[model samples]
Target: MAARLLIGVLAVSGLGLALSLVAGTVLLRDYLYGRVAEQVSGLSQAPDVRPGAIAPSRLCEVTDAPAVLPSDFRLTVIEADGSVRCRVPGDQTGPPVPSVDELRDWADDDAAAVVRDDSGSWATSVDAFDQPGRDGGKGYVMVAISLRNADLTVQRVAVGGAAIGVVVLAVLALAGRMVIRIGLRPLTDVREAAREIRHGDLSARVPPGKPGTEVADLSTALNSMLEEIQRGFEKRRESEQRIRQFATDASHELRTPLTSIKGYAQLYAQMAARNTGSDAGTSIAREARKDVEQRRAEVVSRIDSEADRMSGIVEDLLLLARLDQQPELVKERVDLVEIAHDVLTAARAGHPERRLDLKVEGPVEVEGDPGRLQQVVANLVTNAIVHTPSAIVVAAATTDGVAVLEVRDDGPGMPAEVQHRIFDRFYRADVGRSRRSGGSGLGLSIVRALVEAHGGSLECVSSVARGSTFTVTLPRAS
Candidate 1:
């Protein structure tokens, strides 16, 4: 761009210089011609060049021409009768005289004239000089000066103009380059920042540019967008990590009950095979039958128990997957108070040793799937019962447009960090307790999912040794 600008400027300058040279040369030529004409007009009035009275050769002697003129000047005398005489006829390089027709034309008009011939250009002036004898006779004087000096002067001016124009163009090009560099500096910084970002450096930012300029606004906007993208990228990475961990935990939990059931089934098959062995004595067969029947009953019972545990784990996993993929639950107005009561009753039956309390100040109703809502309450109550030996309290109330429910426990509370991840899939506050008590570690995670699917949110507040409270807030049905 700088180069183009410089070229444009030089082009215009060259054109201007050419025009100036032509104009200056033309004007100078005219001025020199006028000066020569004036000198000729003055010398024509001299008394020495009077009509027929002076002989042609004597005219040059009387005029004192060399004293009054430049070295290059030449004079021509024309008599009234049409004869021509030259002062410097022997100087072949001198200026030429006017033609015969030119002299005749000058005689009739008696005015100054300019004529051109093979020799050079001449400035001529003619007027009637005083007649010396007879009727006044017509005479003429023509003075010619060569234009060589003016041509030389114009040539010198052109060369100087060219040199000056080159200097001016050079200076302009350098200045233009400096200005462009300064203007593009901000953009250069932006380009470098973008390159860094491309290489995974989201923290890179362009330095501030001139305020109120387009470049400044662009930089600010770009930085803001990069910050948001970096934040999102970090969040996504965390989510991916959690998902991977969830899968591993889920596999481990499912494997435990399956392993138990497989062991029980294998034991039953071994016992039955031993009891079926061929025996010769009836007494021995009878005795083996009694023992085998008793052992088979016990083994079957154990297998059924493991099967129940495995079934529960499978059901919980399916529900979670369903909630994640498609949470299109049947929405209806369900009473939170009713769900809380039912969940507490079920929990109390399953955990008879754990004390459970239910408090319903008022009937709190929300729009959600009743079955899923009940599951939410059940999961929370079960979670409380499994994790702690202390009393569990279930509460429900309504205020304004919100339905609130909480299941809290007076058991050993959790740390702040543990509380934060309690609702993550397959996360357990007490891993040892989860394994021993046959807890799937998905209860709270499923609770959160179900609540969120109903356009509600669940939060847990806990402190070490202070107990933990799990709160659910739902939009009340209007």
Candidate 2:
């Protein structure tokens, strides 16, 4: 690109120089000829010639003429009858002279003509040479000044001008190349940085040269993009680590239930074997069998409870996985107030010991999947009931084109540190309590995911000894 720029500049400069040279050369040639014509005309108008007896006029010799006339100027006298005469050394041929008709026209009209021939070029000036005190009676005097030297001068000037133009163009090309290289240095740096980045170096960046230029803007943008990419890569690695840990935790959790079931089954089998192999009296054997049957029933009940707990955890995990994939939801207008009321009624019925307060202004509808939306409300109410022993407040209202649902609890509030990760999957504020209470720790995470999938936002506000509040905001249907 730089080379192309230099070539373009040179081409334009060369064209302008060519035009200037031609105009200047023509002006110089015209001025030189004008000066020659003036001299020839002046010399011809002189009145110092004497006529001969036989010759019509015996013009003064060019060398013997007045000093005002140029030395190389050749003089010619033309009579009224179209005869030509000139005084010159017998050994040298005089230069080409103007024709008789040209001479007569000049003498009659007092005009001049520049004539050229093989011998050389001349500026011819003719004037009537009348005797003193006579009325236009004598012949005409014509003077020819050689233009060979003037032609040679013009040619030399043209050659010098062409050489100067060539030198100027060469200098311009060199200067242009240097300027272009300096101007485009930033681009070279950018290219090298880009190459490094392409090879997996996200930290590479172009150094911003001077500010307030295109290069500076590009550098800033590229650096910003690199920063974003690096952050995304770090986030992805963090997510992968979290997933691996989650898988391990899930396996450990599933194994606990399975292990309990297996232990109970083994105990039941051992008891049955003992009952079958009794070799005592009938009454003692019957009594031992009855005791063994009761113990076996308790073992089976424990196994059934563990299986239910495992099934709940598996179902919650599957729900979370499906939410992660962003499944399409039903797009229907649902009333948040109605959902909140229903959820509150269920929570109150299930946990009658806990006080549930529901405050709903009116119908606040939003476009969403009714089932998912109801699930969101249920999860929040359930999470509050399980975590806190205080009263649960469920509120729904419409404010500023948004449908707001909030579930607040005054139970043993969480710490500020725990509040940050409360919405993370499988994150439990009190792990031991959560496990004993059959809390899968995915309630808040699923609530947040469901809220967001409805084009809304969910946030948790909680502090130790202070009640926790979960607020969900969804855009109201237009």
Number of the predicted model whose TM-score against the real structure is largest: 1
Candidate-wise lDDT, in order: 0.75, 0.80
| Residues 218-300 of candidate 1: C-alpha lDDT, one tens digit per residue | 88998888889989998999989988987788788878778888887898889878877847379978888888889889988
Q: Name model 2 segments beyond 4 Å from true.
A: 45-56, 60-68, 76-94, 97-121, 124-142, 152-156, 159-307, 317-374, 388-404, 410-421, 424-438, 449-457, 473-478
* Deviation (Å) of 111 in candidate 2: 5.6
Worst 10 residues of 2 by lDDT: 47-56
lDDT of 2 by residue, 1-478 (tens): 8888899999999999999999999999999998988877766665443243222244433444434235686666665555655543223444454556765678776445688778778887777665444465566666777898999989999999999999999999999899998988888888898899889887888898689988899888988988898899889988998899677668777888899999999999999899889966788888888899999999999999999989988988898888889988889989988888888888888888989998988889999998899999999888887777789899999999898989998777878788878887777666663476647677788888888888899998887788889999999999
Q: Model 1, poorest ten-residue lDDT window?
A: 88-97
lDDT of 1: 0.75
Candidate 1, superposed: residue stretches over 4 Å from native: 1-59, 62-66, 70-84, 87-153, 228-232, 278-299, 325-328, 429-434
